[model samples]
Target chain A: MTADTTRRQLLAGGAALGWFCINGSWLQSTPAQAQADGFAPQHLSVAQCSAMNVIADALVPGAHVAGIAAYIDSQLSAKNDSLLLVKYLGVPTTAQSGFYRPALDSCIRLLAADGMTPQLALTAMGEDAVSDWQGPPASFFSFVLRADALDVVYGTEQGFARLDIPYRAHITPKKPW
Target chain B: MSNALSTDTVIVGAGAAGLLLAARLAESGRRVTVLEAGPKRSTDDLISSQIWARRLKWSGPQVEELGDHKVGHAFNAGFGTGGSALHHYGVWLRLHPGDFRVASDHGVGLDWPIDYQTLQPHYDKIQSEVGLSGDADAEIWRPEGAAYPMPPMPLFAQARILQKGFEKTGRRTAPLPLAINSQPYQGRAACQFDGWCDAGCPIGALANPLVTHLPRAQKAGVQFEHNALVSRVLRDPNKAARIRGVEYFQGGERHTITAKDVIIAAFTVQSARILLSSAADTTPAPGNRFDQLGRYLTSHPAATVFGLFDEPTYPHQGVSGGQLLSHDDYDNKQQGNGFGSSQWLIAHAIKPHDLLGYGTGRPDIVGNQLEPWLQDAAQHLANMTLVVEDIAAPNNRVTLSDATDTHGIALARTEHNLDARTARLWQQRIDEGQEIMRAARAREVWHGPRVAMHIMGGTVMGKDEQQSVTDSFGRVHDTDNLYVSGPSLFPSSGAVNPTFTLSAIASRQAEHLITQQ
Candidate 1:
């Protein structure tokens, strides 16, 4: 098959293909099943979420490998008790983030309306390729998306740079009693 | 039931000073109990987008004020066991030696009876226990003190960029001494360097009270009563001079906790409120005889300069306040100006919502056309900002509002009350910061209006009984066994975060209180 044909087929069979995309161990050890896990319902559509993932990857470039979006989504969808970011930064309202989903939906819809797919739209949008998809109001949506991106990229093990990991680099220990 | 909560000492407020004091006291076989007004929070509560955590703040029954700018917000202290420390950005710096004697030196603000040298050892002790990460060797501008316990937190794209500007302009930028682990130490993990510290850390990496000190205090059998709002300090009929106990309300129940001594670890604002609320009957009037309880209050009004860069600074990679600092030029109090010293907190990676949005004074903007800007901001996280300090003014005080609430306690009234001299001082620092940013090859440079920082100088510590409310050791002049801790003891709002100095002061007071007992 041609590259475009295969791409279309992959897109059409995304649910099946996504099975391999998720590491089996991670799926099994999902936070939902963890004793401390408080789960929130996933409210967005596949198309909308795929758009967010693509845009987030473009925002940080290395975010997917860093597993940032998953982390952001986890914190966003987890039980209020399980999510720590809300408590620390005082995100104003914990019941609703007020920015994440609506911003994601707007970006996807605007980009899609301009005759671009989710992935291509995000990459093109970065280069200022699509003029019509100006994203959210100048600073507000930018703030939410930037925080979400960082929540994923920097909040993760790779993101925190594993510097916090004990037994890795021992330095200047306190005198024991 | 009394046996359920027994301790040699009970510390109120669970911020940096209280937590450190509790840990140190607990180490010496003292059973310590900390009563916090906020909720009981942990790292797990930090990462969620939940609403309750954000609602953890001090909102008296109702607030009535007359000013364009309302001083007290609904959420002031974190409504958890950790207190406001849960939301603090871990930028740890000692107040300058001169900061201790502001009135004596410049004749501008009230003078602290004790000098910085007196608090130096405590600074060292807290730094050692907390594990500060910074390049002590490079901080030539820093005053005499023991070196930081750990190497500096790694400089990111923004620090490197900002350093170049400082070099180009003949200015200086050193690694900010942070109470975050650069490498694993003290049985706790180091900073993950996620820059999400303002949001709280989940892995117990940052030296927040809950993770670092409170846990140890608990291990040493320190009992904590969360969600307890202390209403007033009740005195006995016989020794109306000495505090008998504290009257508090929790879960809609009015209860009294008797103690030999009462330590007000509540923050400057709340501490002043509690004093004002109780002194209504005890002192024959609110802010009675001395007129010193909450009159000379001041919070270091800070301004920030943001510099945008083309490179991917990844500002979100490190601490919320960033890695590098600029105090070499700003630390000196300008001559002939009534302003005290001012310092620079650089490369702070602000979140788009609060940091970039509300902080920049543009909280209203929302809707479409935001994604592209965010895409750019994510890559350019390496931008820099300067937390320029403002001078102390007595008029910049916290007062009890005449308007009473459902609970009958008065609300906190505040006015920005900045002086012309301090306003000029802010302008000078902003100009210098702008020049530094321009030298660094920034595409755009802008500064935010001055915003208030860690509380200061309401119930100041002094030598003379007539001038101040508390003595140098934080003991009330007339009332025995009533001690105050934290920034409320600050004689001046020096141009630095008060957490470190407050810790040192609290430690000193705790030693005195222990001996006096």
Candidate 2:
């Protein structure tokens, strides 16, 4: 094919190619199915994922269905290719796991105590009232988690539609996150 | 070590400025070679996904940042061929006439060695060449320049709603001058208003260096070396007056290249990093004779105000840079309790994710309330960003980091703190922004944190060698052959986007270089 023809094809096939590339091994197991069937996170532990899910669901309802834990895990696993907004805020790619791991661990420990609801836990985080919390900062961690929750819950076309907004895409995404 | 190569001109950082200069110089029959620290990218790589677009951002050596207002280096800079312009929102605005004489007019901030009149011809030339779309006459705050080649982009529902707010507040607004094509121009397709500009414009609708300058440079026979991180500029051992070439790392090996002239166009921090790292045992870095190599770093303090209007306004129907602009408060540098200029970019096309995303804006609305709040905002949200000019404090600077990268080169360490007056100006504008939002009959209004945007200075241009690193023509004050291009040469932060001004400076520099040769 001519260069012009190839360029046109690439432009037309951009979304499809991106979808396949991102899905890679997860194509067979949709985000919903993975969440339903107890998705195995590659980088995060079970407890870490559990805490992330609870906190994310608290920050953004339907985040569990949107696969917030899976999204964070996938992005963290990508390392340098991470789409986490924290990358734009000073935290380097090499130290990205360091930023998330300890914070999630702190969340798990904090929530493991009796009668700790996601709302109360988040409130405590906002107030820096969590005892023995071992991550960056309770308030900052909550902010970052809240941002991540938003990403998975409303960063896609279907997500936009869920909020009654039009996904007027020049090049449409093949699948929602 | 790899065998040394030679070229007529060696330009570090294949960014907007670098590519533009390379194209012009090569077209004028001078051999040019550009060394880029990141990978090579094409329009094909410019996907619509924000996650995938992260690949376009700066992923090189970490820049250690300190101070109250740390420049968002990684966020503001791009990685590959097009540099930061790859993902830029294409808000092409020229600096005002008063902006060039900040110190003289307002008795605050440094003044530009060259005035707006000196750069006006180049601005007009670049606008014609690159094709900016806007109603030039409507920009009452604009400096004198040629009329825009194309008419302004059509106002979306969000913009129309926000324009009412500006009108109600008795402030004037004009269609934001954008490098984005409003209609098919110079064979490129018109913009689709996809609002995926941060992901890079795959189509040639946005005039990024990928489509605008890189291709022209290639056509003009300018050579490019991607994944080539230039460590430092080399000087002749015998002659202290002249530069020999540059040392770089590629494919896990060190290499050297000799050139007649060297231009460091790496976006702000890294460009400063290269010069600061070049200090030898006997001699200081090329332009550090007066100990002013990495001084006078500045970044615009910016924030966004979001409001929920009763009207159904689709906020995602335009470019990310915004649909309209209000510069009514821009020229008045000495406004109440503050001493700097400020402008409002109204009704930007917003996303749900990322830093400026609408969903990310309200952290308080959570749990069961999250969905409803997001749903309301998705339709009714109208937002505007306030860009406040930062004073060029000498202490706010870029220094060499004690820590070294794997390649054994010291990383760039940036220290930037906003002046008290500048902070007051930011707060003042943000307060007025909410008032304007409420005047438009909004139910709720809130603002984002004050963060730095569009970094400038570090190797500032001035007439005095002791006060600046480069001359008005971007030539290093002390060195004859060494030049610094891009926003790093800016003497002041002018409450406007720096791309147009930087491009014009590069265009002027290209002319000077060709003439000198």
Candidate 3:
């Protein structure tokens, strides 16, 4: 068969599972479960993860447990196939890391300088009042990250049950992320 | 390109129009080949999760946008086998008779080459083929057409409660016409009211291309090449008047497919992008001699109104398109401050999260304040969307961006802006929608920011080359065997979902092609 045929087959045959690298092996797990299991992210540094978790958990409670860092990391690794809503907003997959890495540094800077809480920094970011903030407008980045947090925390079947709505899925998703 | 491919006809894009045309032409004994930019997909791939549904949206190229109103190409365009119709809410509405002559009557926008009467038979034929469900008589504003084949989908608690607002406001409500099967028909099962339409109905109930034309094309021996990103339509070197096939990138290699006929059905932006990229040094692109290839682009200016009533509305109990519709203000485009047609899709099935979710609309409720508010809105929220017609303008267009893809072809850049009249109409409808929500005894009411709904025009059809890129039959004016299909050929932006009208146009094109062949 042709190489193009093989590539098409690979893409079409993707398993409906989010495989995380945990304890030196690949395991199918939700973003939250991957976080709880100490899965190593293929992308994102430890500092970036810490900053993302703090900021996301502050935006939507339980986002840290839901693994917003792991979710964003996994999506970024997928390149053009990334399911992040930022794709709809005109951010190219190749430039996605450029968007996250720098804004995350801004958050790190704010947290380190004033001993400010994550909530305070997030409010400032939302208001576009962060001093010396960099990369994608602070408010826009907050909107995107907040959407990412909501996806991992309440965009799944289990999340629906928490809100007292029936998860009447015609084809239930295999992964939560 | 050593191993060149050849076919009697080469169809670009495996979306609704291409698949329908493929099945019809292949059945007429033509050797047809379809190239899809996205991966191969089946019903099993349609997972019922809002986050998972994002996989169905455009992932091929980044479309840079600029304007007061930008068409949400990535959100509205689709990928994979079934295309955007897979994620569509199945609101299959027909254009009104008055919608055909906006330029001739209102002195704004471009009028369609053909009137609604010429297209009505095809609309009826597509409905019969796809099995639509609606109460035709109840739709007081409906244009002339055949009655739906199946009875309307049943109303739920949310729809019943929302109808009272229309009653009190002296407005009218009708069963929303849908392409979904309300009862078992044509071997497809009935809808189960699972609220998973946008996630794609996997049970063959909703008339997605998967259940409609894809299988028929497969049965008719139409060969499909997945993950083939087409760059441009090639010109026939020996004969300048005739058109050749296409060049595409697949499997990290460039390939060429030569055919007697070529059709571009790559939705709106990409269709215009391909034509713009086809311009070789001296010979302007096919159908672009007058620089009218991507002009007159349009999108419906739409927004959603949400309210939390005291009683349980059970907002998540029906199909995503909503259970009822209001077209009381549809016939009058110049009503109040607005100068365009508008309609309301009422009582849609909703969830607690995702972009259109009520909880997400209220970004102020966060941290500990979120879950409780989400839980309350999940059961008690009532919502509806206002879709206003946009007047097509020459300035709104799709052009080639300076940025190039891996294949070195310029990417698409679109700029679409609303006319002052359309914006005013949208605001008027939004305010009226809020009033109706309050009239329904909603304790709290709010509306989402105005957003772009359906994308259309770009490579619109008209009488001649100076007016548009194609004729009424979608044939490129300068070429003998070049054509375009889908909503890209629309000359006006009617205030309704476009899938049904696009399918009808496809049906007409298929018949014309077959009879001519």
What order do candidates take by lDDT, descending?
3, 2, 1
Model 3 steric clash pairs: none
For residue B234, give model 1's deviation from the true position in Å. 0.6
Please state the error at residue B162 of candidate 3 in Å: 1.2
Q: What are the runs in model 3 whose C-alpha is more than 4 Å off? A: A1-17, A22-29
lDDT of 1 by residue, B202-272 (tens): 66677778787888787877778877777777766687667776766677767667777777888877777
How far out, in Å, is residue B292 in model 3?
0.2
| lDDT string, candidate 2, B220-245, tens digits | 99989999999999988888758889
Model 3 chain B weakest 10-residue run by lDDT: B329-338
DockQ score of the complex predicted as candidate 2 = 0.45
Off by over 4 Å in 2: A1-32, A36-39, A172-177
| lDDT per residue (tens digit) for residues B1-517 in model 3 | 5588999999999988999999999999999999999999999988898888888998887888999998988889999898888899999999998889988888888899999999999999999998899999999999999899999999998888889998999999999999889999899999999898988889989999999999899999999999999999999988766888899999989999999889999999999998899999999988889989999999999999999988999999999999899998887877766699999999999877777877778877778788778888988999999999989899999999999988899999999888998888888889999999999989999999899998999889999679799988888889898989999999998899999888888888888888888
B383: Cα error in model 1, Å: 3.3
Q: What is the lDDT of residue B202 in candidate 2?
A: 84
* Candidate number of the best lDDT: 3
Chain B: TM-scores of all predictions:
0.92, 0.99, 0.99
Candidate 3 chain A: 10-residue stretch with minimal lDDT:
A6-15
Q: Pick the candidate with the highest DockQ.
A: 3
Question: Residue pairs in steric clash, candidate 2?
Answer: none
